[model samples]
Structure formats: C-alpha cells, structure tokens
Target: MRVTMIGTGYVGLVSGACFADFGHVVTCVDKDPSKIERLERGEIPIFEPGLDDLVAKNVKAGRLSFTLDGAEAIRDAEVVFIAVGTPTRRGDGHADLSYVYAAAEEIASLIDGFTVVVTKSTVPVGTGDEVEAIMRRVRPDGEFAVVSNPEFLREGAAIEDFKRPDRVVIGTEDPRARAVMGELYRPLSLSDFPVVYTARRTSELIKYAGNAFLAMKITFINEMADLCEKVGADVQQVAKGIGLDGRIGSKFLHAGPGYGGSCFPKDTIALVRTAQQYGAPVRLIETTVEVNDARKKVMAKRVEAVIGDLAGKTIGILGLTFKPNTDDMRDSPSLDIIPALQAMGAKVKAFDPEGMREAAHLFTDLELVDGPYEVAQGADALVLLTEWDQFRALDLAQIKNRMNQPVLIDLRNIYKPAEARAAGFLYSSIGRA
Candidate 1:
C-alpha cells in the first residue's frame, strides 16, 4: 500500500519506517523543516532503540522517505496516516488538536480519489468525526474515510510493539476503509496478531482509557508504597501478591515516583477533561491525576528528608529521565525534585545514561555530571532517581569513596539496605524497612 504519514515525531517516524520495512511505500511528512531535513540525511531526530538501522534500511530500499511537503506526500498515496502529536493544551488540559487538524485540512486539499485517513495519534473520543468534518470543509470534493487506529508503542520498545502488538484496534465505519487498513497491516497480520475492528469513537477512547488505567495502576502502587512505608511492609511483596492473581496482572505495579512521560500525564488529564466535557466525569481518573501531581512534589520532600537538611547539602542524583531506556525527560519526576532541591539551597549534580542533553535545558543551573560517581563525588548523599540498569550493580566501596558522606536513598528500590549499611553507608529505600 502507498501510505503518507503526517507528523514525523516518535509515532509517525517509527510507524512510517516500520510500514516501509513491511514493503509499503511510505512518505513521512513533517512541517518542521529541520526535523525533515535531519530524517532525509539519515540522522534520526529521536533516540529509539534499533530505529536508526531500520529506517536507514527502508530508505535505502526506496520504501521510506521524509519530506516537508504534506500535500505532495498524500497526492499519490491511497492511505493517509495522521500520526501527529496531540499534546495537552495549556490551561484547558484538553488535547491540542491543532497539529492533527492542520494535517487533516492539508491532506484534504490534496487528496485525490478515495483515501482512508487514519488517526494514529492518541486523540480524544469523537476526534475522528471532527477530522472528517474538517476534511469535507477543506476540500468539498474530497472523499475520505477517517479511521481511528491508536498506537500502543512504548518509547523504548516501539518497533517491536508495532510489529507484534498484543492486538491492533482498528475503528472504521466503512468496509472499504477497513479493507484498505487491513491491506496496509497485512505483513504484521501474518505474525498472528489479532486486529480488532470496532467503532471509531470506541477506538479513540480505548487509547485514553488504556493509558489512564495504566497511570491509575502506577498511582495506586505509589499510594500503596506510601502506606507500606508507614506500616513497615515491603511494596515489592504487596505488588507480588496482587500481581500473582491473573485478574490483576503484573505490569506498571513497580512503585516509584509518580507516572510521568509524554503519554500518561498528558493523556490522563486529557481524558479527565474529555469525560467532564461529555457530562460524565471519571472520578478515579480525576483522583489519579491529582494524586500523581502531589506525588511528584512529595518525592522532592522524600529526598530532602533523606538528606536531613537541604541547605548547603550537595546531593547526587543518579537518573534524570522520567524512566530509563528512553531519553525523554518531558514531565519527568526529576524536573519536580531537582528544582525543589535547588530551591532549598541544595547543590545538585545529576547523571543519566541518555537524558542529560535533553534534561540539561530543563535545569540550567545544575551541574550535569559525567557518571554516577562523578555526580556523587564528595556529595553528601546519592539518590537513585530513575533506576537505570547500570545503577543496579555498583561497587559500594567505590561509591563510598566518591561521596563525602555515604547516604544512599534508593527511590526505585534498586538496591538492598544490607549491602549499603555493611559498606558503611546510611541506606534508605522506598516502602521498605
């Protein structure tokens, strides 16, 4: 299938590259000249594992290409995939559909013949209807079918998720649109992944509901971790107990700082606002939103408490990203904690395997360290913020040697207290004695 992918962000780029890899001719269009130029030069703008090789290979094979010309991309394409970002709008907390809408109108203007316009961005329910309306308004003669096909790719493992999704949720009212989408995904269809066909609105809501539910699960575990701390119970064990039951599966149950990233924070708020707009509020989602917001600041306090006094304290932060394996620092917990620490007159030095360049702009004053030991060098205490894999096994003696005073606060519970205490360090971890 000849496919035109709009908005070459994480989703658009990966999806385009993957579709091209699957033998479809894909043209990824982005308004950002610099981004499109970078993609055209084989320089990937974002850091997704294994994407560079895949995209390069597809481009070499003449299947994948990048461009700033939206209309040109869609001119010859049978299917137009709108994988643009739907970031949360300011103040309103609603998804900012400006990009999605803009792409719709652009595609409408150039669309020729019958085209299956698919929404791969996570939009609020009924967005498909709005896109359809926009299409008709822009190009009165344009014949387009809007299909809701939300992506379920995690940042670190997007390609795999796209190739072997648990199931593909496809929402289209038209049989021709469904058949077109089916043909587009036929390569993955051979992989035995179930492709569920549902109504457009349901498909849109599914993405939000799914992300919000995962955020709730993480928030619930965070709350449980807090309670476990008070009651002298290990949250790891509590998570294990509930996770063992098949009904309550064991994912997103690992208690840590509040959920933050490109998706959960923005998507949950958008869902809450969407529900309110529809005259039916999701109370649990509302609470989840509030609790998670509170949780970020409380994490700052947790670090302060562990450090005893923020003033004049030099604290080493182990991780800066929202979570490890991806360099995305948007809505990261460290954004809340690091500044708070700095506000209290504490000197902060942080390190992340891949997030420093992205996170550096967020904290201009802080000293971005070269490594864990560099961040900890002569620092009063070290805080394990993101739980990167390398931080799992560290030389305790070396860490002790690097720190001024050996205090280790394991926020992600990556280390045991015994080894730290044995190595002459005061060790503290979340939801554990």
Candidate 2:
C-alpha cells in the first residue's frame, strides 16, 4: 500500500515508520518544513525506544520518506492517515480538531483516486463525520472514505505496540475502505492480530473511553496510596492482591504523583467535555481529572513535608520526563511539582537522561545538571519523580553522603523503605510506612 501520513508528530511519525516497516511505501507529510527537513536528514524529532533504528532501516530500504508537500504524496497514495495532534482546547477542554479537519480539507483537494482516509489520531466521537463533511465541503467531487482508526501506541513501547497490537480497530462501513485498511495491516493480520471493525462513532469513543478508564485507575491507586499512608497499610500490596485477579489487570496500578502525559490528561478532560456536551456527563471521569490535577501539587507538599522550610533549600530531582524511555513533557507531573517547589523558594537541580533538553525550555529558574549524583550534590533531599533505570539501583550510601540532609523521597516506590533506612537516610515513599 502507498500510504501518506499527515502531521508527523509522535503518532504520525511512529505509525508511518511502522507501516513502512510492514513493507508499505510510506511518505510522512508535515506542515513544518523544518521538521520534514530534519526527518529527511535522518533526524527523528521525538525520542522513542526503537524508533530511530526502525526509521533508519525503513528509509534505507526505500520504503519510507518524508515530505512537506501533502499533495505530492496524497496523489499517489491508497491510504492517507491523519495522525495529527488533538490537543485539549484552550477553554472548553474539548479536543481541538482544527488540525485534523485542516488535513482532511487538504487531502480532499489532493487525493487523486479512491483513498481510505483514516483518522489515526485520538479524537472525539463524531469527528470522523465532521472530517468527512469537511472533505465533502472542500471538494464535493472527492472520492474518499473517512475511517476512524485511533492509535494505541504508548510512548516508550510504541514500536512493540504498533508491530504487535492486541487489537486493531477499523471504523468504516465502506467495503472499499475496509479492504484497503485490511491490506494496509495485512502483515499484522497474518500474525493473527485481532482487527475489530466497528461503527465510526464507537471506534472514536473507544479511544477516549479506554484512556479515561486508565486515568481513573491511576487516580484510584494514587488515592489509595494516600489512604494507605494514613491507615498504616501498603498500597503496593493492595495493588498486587487486586491485580492478580483476571477481571482487574495490574497495568497502570502504580501509585505515583498522578497521570500526566500526551494522552491521559487531555483525553480524559476532552471526554468529560464531549460527554457533557451531549447531556450524558461522566462525573467519574470529571472527578478523575480533578483528583489527578490536585495530586501533582500534593506531591510537592510531600516533598515540602520532608524538607520542612522550603525557602532556602536546594532539592535534587532525579527525573523530569513523565515516564522513562520517552522525552515527552506535555503535561508531566514534574511540570507541576517543580514549579510548586520553586514558588515556595526551594531551588531545584534536576537530571533526566532524555528529557533535559526539552525541560530546559520549560524551566527557567532551575539548574539542569548532567548526572543523578551531580544533581544530588549538596541538595537537602533527593526526590525520585520518574523512575529511570539509571535511578533504579543507585549507590544509596554515596547519595546519602553527598546530600546536605540524608533524606530520600521515592515517589515511584523504586527503593525499599528498609534499605533506605539502613543506608542511614530518612526515607519517605508512597503508601508504605
């Protein structure tokens, strides 16, 4: 299949590269000439685990290319994928679909023959209909089928997820579009990957509903961690016990600052807005969004509790990105926690293996350091926000000696409380006494 992927953000880039790896000729189109130039020069904008290698291999094999001209690629493509960002709107919390619609309009004018236009971006329900309407309005003579095919790729494990998705959801009633989509994913189909064909609206809702539920689970565990702390119980044990049950899986059960990333925060808020717009409000998800937002500041309070007076303290932070293996800082909990700490007059020195460059642009007052030990040097307390592998098994004694006060606050629960205590440090961890 000759595929043209528009808007080469995380979704577009990854999906395009993976499709190319599947032996499809893929051209990733972006409006930004600089981003397209970077891709053409063998530079990947975002950091994913195996994406650089995958893109390199595919480009070397002549199956993948990058372009700034969507018309050039769409004219020769069988499948045109709109993988643009559907960020939360400024005031309404609804998904900003302007980019998706813009891409649809451009594709409507550009596509030559019958094309299966798939919305691979996470969008609100009925967005496919709007996209189809936009295409028709722009070019009434256009022959294209708008299909909702939302992506489920995680940031860190996007390559693995794309190559071996648990299920592929294709939302379109057009038989031609279905056949084209099926052929596009035939490589995975041969491996028996489940491909669910559903109504367009249901497929769009599935993406939002799945993200909202995961966000709720994370918030639930975070609240449980708070309760466990008050009641002298361990949330980890609770999570383990309940996770063993087949009904409730263990994924996203870790108690941390909160859920913050490209998907959860925006998607959950968008879902709440979308549901309320139709008079079927999801109060549970609304509460989830509230709790998660408040949890970030609460985490700063946890650090404050350990440090006492924050005015003249120099706190060492171990990670800046939302999670390990990805440099995305869209709505990272650190964005909230670091700022809150600074507002209270605590100077922060942070280190993240991949996130420092982006974090530098976001933070102005903090000092970005080189290594974890360097960040810990002369700091009052060491706080672990993102559980990077480098921070997992650090020299505890060395860290304790380097810090001004021998304090360790493990928000990720990566260290044992007993071990930290044995290392002669006052330790604070989530949900464990």
Candidate 3:
C-alpha cells in the first residue's frame, strides 16, 4: 500500500517509519521545512530508541521518504493518515482539532481516487465525524472514508509496541475502508495480534478510557504510598500483595511522584471535559487529575521534611525527563517539584542522560550539570527524581563522600533503605516505615 502521513510529529514519524518497514511505500509530510529537511538528511529529530535505525533502513530500501509538500503523495496514496498533534486547548481543555481538520481539508482537495483516511492521533470521541464533515465541506464529491485508528505506542518503546501491539483497534463501518486498514496491518494480523473493528466513537473512547484508567491506577498507588508512610508499611509490598491477583495484575502500580508524559495528563483532562459536555461526568477521573497534580507539588515538601531548613541549601536532582529513554518533558514531575523547592529557597542542579537539552528550555535557574556525580558534588541533598538506568547502581559511598551533607531522597524508591542508610547517609524514600 502507498501511504501518505501528514504532520511529521512523534506519532506521524514513528508510524510512517514503521509502516515503511512493513514494506509499504510511505511518504511523511510536514509543514516545517527544517523537520522535513532533517529527515531527508538521515537526521532524526526525536530521541526514540531504534527509530533512527529503522528510518534509515527503510529509507535506504526506497520504501520510506519525507516531503514538505504532500500534494503528489496524497493524490497517489491509497491511505492518508492524519497523525497530527491534538494537544489540549488553552482554557476549554478540549482537544485542539484545528490541525486535524486542516489536514482533512488538504487531503480532500488532493486525493484523486478511493482513499482511506485514518486518524492515528489520540483524539476525543466523535472527532472522526467532525473530520468527515470538514472533508465533505471541502470536497463534496470526494470518494474517501474517514476512519479512527488511535495510536497506543509508548514514548520510550514505541517501535516494539507498534510491531507487537496488544491489540489493534480500527474504527470503520465501510467495507472498503476496513479492507484497506486490514491490509495495512496484515503483518500484525499474520502474527496473531488481534485487530478489533469497532464503531468510530467507541474506538476513540477506548484510547481515552485506557489512559484514564492507567492514570487512576498510578494515583491509587501514590495515595497508597501516603497511607503506607503514615501506617508504617511499605507501598511496594502493598502493590505486590494486590498485584498478585490475576485480575488486578501489576502495571503502572509503582509509587512515584505522579503520572506525567504526553498522553495521560492531557488525555484525562480532555476526557473529563468531553464527558461533561455530553451531560455525563467521570468523577473518579476528575479526582485522579486533581490528586496527580497535587502529588507532584507535594514531593518538594518530602525533601524539606528530611533537611529541616531549605534556606540557602543546594539540592542535586538525578533526572529531568518524565521517564527515561525519551527526552519529552511535558508534564514531568520535575517540572512541578523543582520549582517548588526553588521557591522555598533551595538552589537546584540536575542531570539526565538525554533530557537535559529539552529540560533547559522548560526550566529557569536550573543548573544542568555534566553527570550524576557532578550533581552530587557539594550538594546538601540528593533527590533521585527520575529512575534512569544509570542512576540505579551508582557508587553510594562515593556519592555520600562528595556531597556537602549526605542526604538521599529516593522518590522512585530505586534503592533499598538499609543499603542507603548503611552507606553512611541520611536516607528517605517513599512509602516505607
């Protein structure tokens, strides 16, 4: 199949590259000249693992290409995917669908024959209808089927998730459209990955519902961590006790600062607003959003409890990205926690293997250092913010000696309490007696 993907952002780039690797001719289109230029020159703009190699391999095989203008690609393609960003609107908290709608209009004008237009970006329910309406308004006689195909790829492990998805939910009632989508995902279907065909609205809701549930799960564990702290219990054991049941399982149960990334924060808020607009409300999700927001800010106080006075204190931060292996800083816990510490008269120095370049723009007065040891040097306290792989097995004794005062606040609970304490440092962690 010949596929034209509009808007070469994270979703577009990754999906286009993967589709090309599946032996489809893919042309990724972006309005940004520099982004398209970078892709053409074998330079990947994002830091996803194995993505550069995948893109390079497919491009060398003449199956993947990049373009600034997608007119020719759209006219010749059998499938045109609107993989643009649907970020939250400023005040309304609704998904900003302008980019998706604009892509529909452009695709409507250029598509020559039968085309299956797929929405690969995470969007609110009924967006497919609106996109169809917009395309019809632009070209009334165009023969195109608008389908909803929301992406569920994680940031750090997108390629693996794309290749071996738990399931593929494709939304379409049109037989021709379903056939095209099926052929597009034939590789996965052949490998026994389930492809669920559903109504467009249901497919859209599935993405939001799945994300909201995961966000709520994280919040539940975080709340449990607080209760465990008060009751002299360990939250890790609590998670283990509950997770042993096959029904509950164990994912997103780690007690950390909070849930933060591109999807959860924005999608939960969008779902809440969408539900209210439709004369129904999800109160649990509303509470999940509220608690997760408060959790991030409250983490700074945990450090204060150990150090006593924050006035003129220097704190070392371990990680800055929301999670490791990706440079995305959107809604990261460090964004909330670091500023709170600074407001309380603490100076902060931080290090992350990949996130520092992007973190520099989101933070002010934050000292980005060379390495984890550099962050530890002369600091009054060390806060392990994000649990990068490198930070897991640091020389605890060496870090203890380098700090002005030996203090370790393990937010992610990456270190054993006894081991940290035995290293001759004042140690504090989440949800343990």
Candidate 4:
C-alpha cells in the first residue's frame, strides 16, 4: 500500500519506517524543515532503539522517504495517517486536537481518490467524527473514511512493539477502510496477532482507558511501597506474590518515584477531562494523577532525609530521563527531584547516558558531568533516579572512594540493601527494609 504519514515525531517516524519495512511505499511528511531534512540525510531526530537501522533499510530499498511536501505525498497515497502529538491543552487538560484537525483539513484538499484516513495519534473519543466532519466541510466531493488506529508503541522499544503488538485495534465499520487497514497490517496479521475491529469511539476510548489503567497500576504499587516503608514490609515480595496470580500479571508493578512520560501523564489527564465532559467522571484516575504529581516532590524529601542537612551538600544523580533507553525528559521524576534538592541548598551533579543534551536546556545551573564517577566526586550522597543498566553494575568501592560521604538512595530499587550496606554506605531503597 502507498501510505502518507503526517507528523514525523516518535509515533509517525516509527510507524512509517515499520510500514515501509513491511514492503509498503511510505512518505513521512513533517512541517518542520529541519526534521524532514534530518530524516532525508539518514539522521533520525529521536532516540529509539533499532529505528535508525529500520529507516535506513527501508530507505535503501526505496520503500521509505521523508518530505515537507505533505500535499504531494497525500495526493498519491492510498492511506493517510495522522500521528501528530495530541498534547494536553493548557488549563483544561483536554487533548489539544488542533493539529489532528488541521491535518485532516489539509489532507482533505489533496487526496485524489478514495483514501482511508487513519488516526494513529492517541486522541480523545469522538475525534474521528470531528476529523470526518472537517474533511467533509473542506472537500465536499472528497471520498475518505476516517478510522481510529491508536498506536501502542513504547518509547525505548517502539519497533519491537510495532512488529509484535499484543493486538491491533482498528476502529472502523467501513468495509473498504477495514480492508485497507488489514492489508496495511498484513505482515502482523500473518502472525498470531489479533486485529480488533470496533466503532471509532470505542477504539479511541480503549487507548485512554488502557493508559489510565496502567497509570493506576503504577500508582497502586507506589502507594504500596509507602505502606511497606511504614509497616516494615517489603513491597517487592508483595508485588511478586500478587503478580503470581494469572489475572494480574506483573508488568508495571515496580515501585518507583512515579509514572512520568509522554503518554501516561498527558493521557490520564486528558481521559479524566474527557470523561467529566461526558458526565461520567473517573475518580480513581483523578486520584492517580494527584498521587503521582505529589510523589515526585516527596521523592526529594526522601533524599533530603538520607542526606542530613542539605545546606552546602553536593548530591550525585545517576539518571535523568524518565526511563532509560530513550532521551525523553517530559514529566521525568528528575525534573522534580533535582530542583527540590537545589532549593534545599544542595548542589546537584547528574549523569545520564543519553538525556544530558536535552536536560541541559531544562536546567542551566545544573552541573552536567562527564561520567558516573565525575558525578560522584565530592558528592555527599548518590541517588539512582532512572534504572539504566550501566548504573546497575557500577563499581561500588570507587563510588564510595569518590563521594565525600557514602549515602546511596536507590529510588528505582536497582541495588540490594545488604550489598550497599556491606560496601560501607548508608543505603536506602524503596519499599525495602
């Protein structure tokens, strides 16, 4: 199938590349000249594992291309995919659908024949209807089917998720649109992957409901971690015991600072606002949002308690990005933790394998260092904010030697308490005594 993918961000770029890899002719269109130029030169603008190789392989085979000329791409395309960002609107927490609607209007003017216009961006329910309405208003004679096909790609493991998705949800009753979608995802369809066909509204709600549940799960475990800390119990054992039940399989059960990323924070808020607007409020999700926002700030206090007086103290941080393997700093716990520590008079030095370049602009006064040891040097305590694999096997003795005082706060719970204590450090971890 010939596909035109609009908005070459994470979802658009990954999906376009993967579709191209599956033998479809794909043109990824972005309004940003620099982004399109970068993609054209084989330089990907984002950090996702295996994406560059996939894009390169598809481009070499003449299946994938990048361009700023969206009209040209849409004119020759059988399917147009809007994978633009639906970020939360300022003040209202509603999904800002201006980009998606604008893309639909522009696509309406350019599509030559019958085209399946798909929404691959995570959006509020009823967005497909609005897109369809906009297309009709812009081009009365145009024939197009608006289908909701929300993406479920994780940042670090997007390519793998795209290829081996748990299930593919295609929201469209239009037979032609369904057939086109089926053909587009035929590569995955050949496997055991299940493709669910539902009404457009249900499909859109599924994306938000799914993210809200996962966010709630993470918040539940985090709250359990707090209870475990007070009751002198281990949350890890509790998670393992509960996770053993087949009904509640262990996925996002790890107790950490909180859930923070592109999807969960924004999606949960958007869902809450959407549900309330429809006269059915989700109070649990509202609480989840509140708990998570407070959790990040409380994490800083945990660090403060571990490191006596923060006045004139230096603290070393191991990770910056919300999670490792991707350089996305949106809503990362470090964004909250670092500034809170600084406000308490502790100078901060941090190291992240990939997040520093982006983190630099967020914190100008922050001392971004060369490596872990450099961050450890002259620091009173070390905190593991994100669970990067490299930080898991660091030389403990070297960290102790470099630090002014040996205090280790493992927020991600990556280290054993015995091991850190034995290494001559005052060790503290989440939900473990």
State the lDDT of candidate 4 residue by residue for 1-433, as single tens digits: 8999999999999999999988999999999999988999999898998999999999999999998888888999999999999998998889999999999989999999999999999999999999999999999999899999999999999999999999999999999999999999999989979999999999999999999999999999999999999999999999999999999989999999998989999999999998899999999999999999999988889987887779899999999999999999999999999999999998999999999999999985799999999999999999999999999999999999999999999999999999999999999999987
Runs of candidate 1 with Cα error greater than 4 angstroms are: none
Query: Any runs in candidate 4 off by more than 4 Å, and if so which?
Result: none
Q: What is the C-alpha lDDT of each candidate?
A: 0.90, 0.92, 0.95, 0.94
Give the alpha carbon lDDT tens digit for every residue of 224-339 in model 2: 99999999999999999999999998999999999889999999999999999999999999999999999897788998888798999999999999999999998999999999
lDDT of 3 at 317: 99
Taking every candidate in turn, the Cα RMSD to the unseen true structure, in Å, is 1.0, 0.8, 0.7, 0.7
TM-score of each: 0.98, 0.99, 0.99, 0.99
For candidate 1, the C-alpha RMSD (Å) to the true structure equals 1.0
279 Cα displacement, candidate 2 (Å): 0.2
lDDT of 3: 0.95
Error of 3 at 422 (Å): 0.6
Best by lDDT: 3
Residue-level lDDT for 8 in candidate 2: 90
